[model samples]
Target: MELKKPSDNCFTEVDGFGVAICNYAGDQNHLAILYKNPQKPDDVKLFHVNSYKSDLLTPVESHYLWVDIDWLPPIRKIAITANLKNIIDNNKDTKIRYGFSFNLGCFDPVTGKINNFYDSADGFTCATFVLEVLKSLGVELVDWNSWPVASPEDINFKQYILSQLESYSVKYPDIVTEEFLLGQKNKINDPRFKPQEVIAATKCKEASTYNSIQKPAQLVHEEVLSYSN
Candidate 1:
C-alpha cells in the first residue's frame, strides 16, 4: 500500500505485500511494521526503521521491510505507518545485524546463519531500498525510462528510488504521487539525479533487460515452511 492520498487506508495482501509512507517534509522520518498475534491479543511484534537507523549505515540509506504471511501468526489486520512511538525493537538481543537500513534477519537454525543480512547494499537510498524490496517479491520496475538512469557505473541509489517513485506516480494516475515523494529528502539528490539517459540504440537491450529483470524464484532452493488455517 502506497500511502499517497488523504484517505488511502487499506493494505492489499498478495503473495507479496508492501507498504510505503513517503514523508519527505517531516522533521523526523520513521517507518514501522507491526504484527499482532491472533491467539494472544496482547502479544505483538514491532519492527521499525527511521532516520536514526538509516544514519547508522555509514553514509546512510533508506530502508524497507518485507514479512512473509506464512511465517507470521494469523492476524486479522496489520497497521503500517510513519512516526509511531515507543515501539519495541523486533531484533533486540539478536546476533543478526539489526541496525543497518537494509536488513534480512530471517534465521535458519540448520545453517546457523541469518538469511539476507547486511552487505555493501546496506548503504542504499530510499530508491534502492524500494527497488530491492520489489525485486525480492518478483517485480521489476526497471525500464528504459526508469529514474536516475545513469550508466550502472555512475548510478546513485537515492536518485534512482525517487525517480522510480515519480515514474510510478505518472504510470498510475489514480494513485497519489505527491505523498510518495514527501519524506525526508535523501542526502544525495544532486545534479546527477536529473540527467536522463538517452537510449541511442537497442544494442544493449538484452543486457539492460537482464539487469533490470528479477531473478527467477525457483533458483533459490530454500525450503519455505507454511501452515494452513
Candidate 2:
C-alpha cells in the first residue's frame, strides 16, 4: 500500500477534514484528495489510502498531492482534491485520513499556486489564503508551528500521508529520471518534485522549517530536492 511512513501532523480538531495522495509509475501516475471523516476514517468518504498499490509495478511515478480546506455551502466545506490518477486500478479500500487543517486557496480554480494562502503563528491552523474567510466562518487562526511532528508513526493520518508521499516521491524520479527525460527532453519532462506541496498539503511545511533550522540539512527552503543540491 505505498504506506511507507506516517506524517506527524494534526490538521483538524473537528470530525472530518481533507487530504491528497499520489503515485506514479513509468510515464504514468495518479493523485487524489481524500475526504476523511472521523466517523469512518478507514471507510473514508472519498478515495481510499491503499488505492495506490493496486497498480503493480517494478518502478512507479511518485507525485505530490494535498489536503486543504475549502468553503462549502458558505458554512460547510469540501476539499479541492488536486492530483493525477495515472493508474487504472485505484483501490477503494482503505482511505487514510490527515490531521492537517489547512485548506486550498484557488489561484485560478485549477492551479495549486500559492498566490493567496498565508501563514500564522498561532499554531495548528489550516494553510492560509489572504482572505479571512475561515475567520468569518468562525475558524480561529491557529499557530502554524503546531502542525507537523518528526515521524508519522507517532501520529495517525499525519504519518500515513507523509509515508505515502515519501514512497511516491522516491519513485517519481525513477520513471521521470534524466535518462528517461533525455529521450523526450521537453519542458514537460521536467518532473520537479514538490516537497513543498507534500509539506504544504500535509501542513508539515512549517515543521520542516523548524527541523531544517535544527539540522540545517541545506541552506534553502525545500524547492525541488533534486533542484536543491
Candidate 3:
C-alpha cells in the first residue's frame, strides 16, 4: 500500500488494517497500526505498543500518512483485528514494557511465542510492535537478512536504554523488575531495525540493503511522500 495523507473520510472510508507514519518528538519517525474497529465498522483506531503507558488501542486522529494494506482480503483483515483484540484482553493487567529486540525475525505469531530476549524486555518499540503484529498474519514487510548487523551507535543506544531502565526501576520497582533489566542486557549487541527502514521497505520490490546509521526522520518522511506522488 502507498503512503499518503489521510482524507476527510480517512477513518470511515477504510475497513481494515493500515499503518500510520508520523514524526515523534520532532525527531524520529514512529509507526502505529491502524485497524477498523470490529464493533463499529465505520470507525478506525490506532493500536501500538509505545514507550508510554501500554494503551494499545485508541481512536485514530492527528495528521498521519495512512498506509492501508489494500491487498489483504476482507476476511483476513477481520481475523487480524480479532487476534489483536485477544492479545489485549489477555494482557489487560500486564504492562508490556517498551524495548527493542534483534530477534524479531524469530517470533512465532501463531503461538504468540517470542525469543528469550524479547520475553525479558517485556515490550517493543512502536515500529517493531506493528511489524510483529503484521508478521503474525504472515505479512513480511522487509528482508530481515538484507539489513545490516548492529553498529557501534546501536550499542551505545543500548547503554542509554539500560540507564533509562535503571531509572525507571528505581521509580517504579514493581513495574521494571531486576529480571527485566537482565533481559535488556542479554541482547546488547543485537541489530535493531529502525522506523525509517520499515518505511523504505514499503517502496522496495526486492531485498534491499539499508544503511547501518539511522537517517533523519524528515528525509524518510519526504521519501515516502515522493513515493505517493
Best by the lDDT measure: 3
Task: Flag regions of model 3 displaced more than 4 Å.
Answer: 7-9, 73-75, 78-82, 88-91, 102-118, 203-219, 223-229
The best candidate in terms of TM-score: 3
Please give the distance, in angstroms, between residue 192's alpha carbon in candidate 1 and its true position after superposition: 8.2
Deviation of model 2 at 32, angstroms: 6.3
- The residue pairs in collision within model 1 are 23-182, 23-183, 24-182, 24-183, 24-184, 127-161
Q: lDDT tens string, model 3, 56-91?
A: 776676666666565566788788767765554454
By TM-score, the better pick of 2 and 3 is 3
Task: Summing lDDT over every window of 10 consecutive residues in candidate 1, give the lowest-scoring window.
Answer: 220-229
Whole-model lDDT per candidate = 0.29, 0.29, 0.64
52-166 per-residue lDDT for model 2 (tens digits) = 2232111211233334543323224423111111111232231212213233332222332223342211111112221112232333333334335334332433444445544
Ranking of models by TM-score? 3, 1, 2
RMSD of each: 16.4, 15.6, 4.5
The alpha-carbon lDDT assigned to residue 7 of candidate 3 equals: 67
Q: Give the C-alpha miss distance for residue 124 in model 2, angstroms.
A: 30
TM-score of every candidate relative to the true structure: 0.29, 0.24, 0.75
Residue 39's lDDT within candidate 2 is 40
* Greater-TM-score candidate between 1 and 2: 1
